[model samples]
Target: MVVASRMLFRFSIVWFVAVVSCFSQDSSQTYEVYVSKNLIGTLIEAKIISKDVNSSKKILYHAFKEIERIDSLLAWQIPTSEISKINSYAGKSPVKISYETYSILERSLTYSESSNGIFDVTIGPLTQLWGFNGDEEPTTVPDKKAIDSCLKLVGYKDLILNSNDTSAFLRRAGMSIDLGGIGKGYAIDRASDVLKRNGLTSFLFNAGGDVLVSGYKAEDQNWTVGIKDPRKEDKLLGSVELTDKSIATSGDYERYFEVDGKRYHHIIDPFTGYPASNSVSVSVIAESAERADALATTVFITQGITGWQGTSDEEFLIVTNDLKNIFSPGFKKKYHFKSIK
Candidate 1:
């Protein structure tokens, strides 16, 4: 429950974020490219374009290495991972964790409390009950009794964080944290920092479609991104131009299963232990990919634009299953979305 509560607090604008075709990179020779052996069950590709081609190759290697390092530390599947250790000691005692893990959990708890439990990190119990704890094919419908029992162990309130001691404790045993939702975005953010510090300026870091662009893709053109169409296979609902920003999306169509005319997806609702059905998908644009990722899931769980309006400081677009499009007034004002109809 400790790690689970921490996971869902960040927006997982998963699957809604996609890349569009750009001009062919004839200048590919002037870039540093890196693809890592480390896999987080999520795709991570980062590109750094450089005026000085010689330096970029080494930069790319380290950039990808940095992402792999973060993935190793955060992935819950790894038995020796810190999150795994936390779950192992659940309800037993506080286990001292790294400063980075402690920091993430602290912010996670704050978001959980502030979101009124809508965005919870301790949702592991429910996620497991629903069979969302694994990366295999979408799971079958769990019995309602199983869900209720798991719900008893779920809540962000149960994840206790001690800043002074740099540790965390789960109020109950049998609870685990899954960072699958927000960890990708967090990894992207950290990798981006690594790039910036190494003196690379213009590039795109796409970690499993959660995209963050820095500066213009070209002299006068910003990076172009697209949001997937929930109803259509392999088609984009619309595209947006971005520079120095991060955009993420969460949709019902991403990962799910259907049986007897009913559908179940991975975005397990922390409260109901079911897939959130309020919106077909939600896209969030924020200054940080981490925030955008977190907002995408939180807003979808909020159900619609109206529910998200009063609290969110970021711009968003919510597409509900009914085909109604909801855009924040701020989004409508600052950005021009193409004719999506």
Candidate 2:
């Protein structure tokens, strides 16, 4: 209860301040999707290129349903979820998972290894320990002792995967996996694939600004994406041209609280068990939404811009805690900033 109160308090402040800014040309047809019980919302716009409104709407409904199903299967806390079942077997034995679950976990482990454990999916305990698993402010900061205890529950190396058996096991009792970092982006990419398979092109799939663009807009203009200004919610820092790619932005300003003039945000460092400091936001544009989203969080947790080294070859933008900006080599070549002066 104490932890819940803190999370609620912090999120109340964040939502109170969040301002979503978007701009589009006049020729697009707008469609609103309200999937029952899904936490994320999406806005899809396509030109009137398709004459069949009924068919288009049907395609969208199925697409949304597919996303919801993926979320349900992967959610760790949901009692009936596949992940919950795997968690139920944490220390006893390797629990066999669905093919999809196995695939995502395999990919997550690969990413964790690639990032040198910087992008661990097994940081669930630390995430919830700091009052970030849900929406709220913590009643109090956890004691270093308690936090250290939870930190023991982390470590991607402890997760054992059996390829032949298609099973997963966490060596420790309390260790668990959380896909919050990459699940949404994976779902977006999957939905985009589904749409393409259904013969629908030229659509945008976005979940709270983690977006994927598969085809060109109706008028043949590139998909225009606006990056939110981390310092000012009502303003945009820049816009990027997306011919065929995905974009994901992670920022501290979207979820944070200030106490005694010190700020605490939602992005947690696996090594530190606290909100990562220095970088305020990181936006990644990549060939896959999953990679973009994972890298966004990974880059934000890395201090002193050293993390930029791993992404030097990719297209990305970094907004520092003090508002200093760093763009990847390709980002400046493809986009323009609205506010940098």
Model 1: residue 320 alpha-carbon error in angstroms: 0.4
Tens digits of per-residue lDDT, candidate 1, 1-341, equal 97876665543433223222243344444544444443567677666667666577677777777777777777777888888888889999999999998888887776666667777777777776666557567547988899888888887788888889899999799777777667888888887888789988788888777899887776787777887888886678788888888888888776788989887887878888888888888888888887787778788888745345234447888888787778787775555567465
TM-score between candidate 2 and the true structure = 0.84
Worst 10 residues of 2 by lDDT: 19-28
Deviation (Å) of 48 in candidate 1: 2.0
Name every residue pair that clashes in candidate 2: 6-136, 6-137, 6-138, 7-136, 7-137, 7-138, 8-136, 8-137, 9-137, 10-137
Q: What is the alpha-carbon lDDT of model 1 when measured against the actual structure?
A: 0.76
Instruction: Residues 258-302, candidate 2: write the lDDT tens digits.
Output: 878887888888888878886888998888889898888888888
- Please report how far candidate 1 places residue 290 from its true position, in Å: 1.0
The segments of candidate 1 whose C-alpha lies over 4 angstroms from its true place after superposition are: 1-38, 133-135, 306-313
